[model samples]
Target chain A: DAGVTQSPTHLIKTRGQHVTLRCSPISGHKSVSWYQQVLGQGPQFIFQYYEKEERGRGNFPDRFSARQFPNYSSELNVNALLLGDSALYLCASSLERDTEAFFGQGTRLTVV
Target chain B: SQELEQSPQSLIVQEGKNLTINCTSSKTLYGLYWYKQKYGEGLIFLMMLQKGGEEKSHEKITAKLDEKKQQSSLHITASQPSHAGIYLCGADLGGSSNTGKLIFGQGTTLQVKP
Candidate 1:
């Protein structure tokens, strides 16, 4: 079975621009979450969705938002990106809430 | 705010030696998870422990949850090059955190010298 899959593997955007990262959860998985991992740091939780509903959000600013689809896929959107937003954006999926999560390869975003 | 702290931020051990990394949380952990990652890559799940005093092992890697449920340790025996990576511990914030939000530690980087 395929694990969580992310799109574009790598991207480059300028400050004040917007970027959208996509993730497709594994088959049979119902929960999807997003995390931001800066260099030399651990992944920080962003948003989590289950059954197409927002279940949890982290300390990120309002500029960072995400939503889940009925099909269990997810998209993370960042508006007016800043240089600090440049990092590896990871997507993880689990069988259910509070369960072990499997991660995707992640999308590397670089803002200049 | 909940925080996870890992000890010995970095380690370099001989290939045949053993090493242990610890993860501690400010709050009691409802669930503790171990994951490994290479630089610039996604996390690879290792194991998960929920009950206090619980212990689990996979291959040469072993993980244990403390009785207080606020700490976890990962031990690797006869380490190999393949085990060289950043080990991270994540804690589940139970109660209002029904979404399975995991707070991760800063991570411990392990390097095995052959």
Candidate 2:
């Protein structure tokens, strides 16, 4: 079975610009969550969606937003990108809560 | 706030040696998960411990959840080059977080020398 997949393996943008990262969850997976992983640190939770609904959100600023598609795919949008927003944006999918999660290769964003 | 904290932010061990990584959470977690990631790659789930005092093993890796359910440990037996990576511990606060919104620790990077 194919695992989670992400688009635009790498991206570059200037400050104050906007970017969108896409994610396709594993087959039959109903949950999709987004995380931001800066260098030398762990991934920070951003948003989580289940059954096409916004289930939870993290402590990110209003610049970060996300949505889930009917097919369980997800998109993470970052507005007014800052250099600090440059990190590996990871998308993880799980069958359900407390279940093992599969991750995508992630979108590496670089803000100049 | 960061609810989970990991120890030994980084470690170096010789090949065939054993090492253990610890993770502690400010709040009791409903589920604790261990994941490993190679530089520039995605994370791979190692194990998940839900109930307190639970233990599980996979190949050379073993994990245990403390009875208090606020702490967990990952022990790698006979560490190898393949085990050289960043190990992250994630905790799920049982609440409305059914979407697998896990809170992760800062991570411990293990370097094994041959």
Candidate 3:
């Protein structure tokens, strides 16, 4: 079975622009979460959704948001992107909350 | 807020040598997880420990959880080139919700010298 899949694998956007990254969870998974990983740093939590409802959010700016679909696919949206927004966006999926999460290859976003 | 601190941020070891990395948490850990990530790749889950003094081993890798001390350690024996990567330890705070919010350490980068 395929693991969590994310696309497009790479992206580039200009400052003040918006970008949407997508993720398709593994089959039979019911939870999806988003994380941002800057170079030389561990990933920081962004948002987590279960059963198509927002379950938790991290200490990110209001410009960052995400939602999970009925099929358990998720999309991460960043508005008013800044140079600091350039980083790797990772998506994870699990059978349920608090379980082991499997990650996708991640989308590398570059804002200039 | 909970935080995880990993010791020996990076290490270089010769092939066939053994090395260990430690992860200390500021607060009690309901569950501890170990993951390995190669450069430009997503994290790969290694193991998870939930009980105090629990230890698990996979092939040449071993991980231990000391719940009483809020500490965990990962050890690799007879390391090989394939063992070179970033090892990260994550903690579950176990909040009212099951969001699976994980607090991770800075990570330990390992280099295996051939």
Which model scores highest in lDDT? 1
Clashing pairs in 1: none
Q: Per-residue lDDT of B1-114 in model 3, one digit per residue for the tens?
A: 328889889999999999999999867888888999998789999998888999999999999988584999999999999999999988776643243578788889999999
Q: Where does candidate 3 stray beyond 4 Å?
A: B95-99
Sorted by DockQ, highest first, which candidate order results? 2, 1, 3
Clash count of each predicted structure: 0, 0, 0
DockQ of each: 0.67, 0.68, 0.63
Candidate 2: residue B68 Cα off by (Å): 1.0
TM-score of chain B of each: 0.93, 0.94, 0.92
Model 2 agreement with the true structure over B1-114: per-residue lDDT tens digits: 568889889999999999999999878878888999999789998898888999999999999999999999999999999999999998787643353688899999999999
Instruction: Give the whole-model CA lDDT for all candidates, comma-separated.
Output: 0.91, 0.91, 0.89
Error of 3 at A51 (Å): 0.6
Rank candidates by lDDT, best first. Answer: 1, 2, 3
Evaluate model 3: give its TM-score.
0.96
What is the full ranking by TM-score, best candidate first? Answer: 1, 3, 2
Q: Estimate each model's TM-score.
A: 0.97, 0.96, 0.96
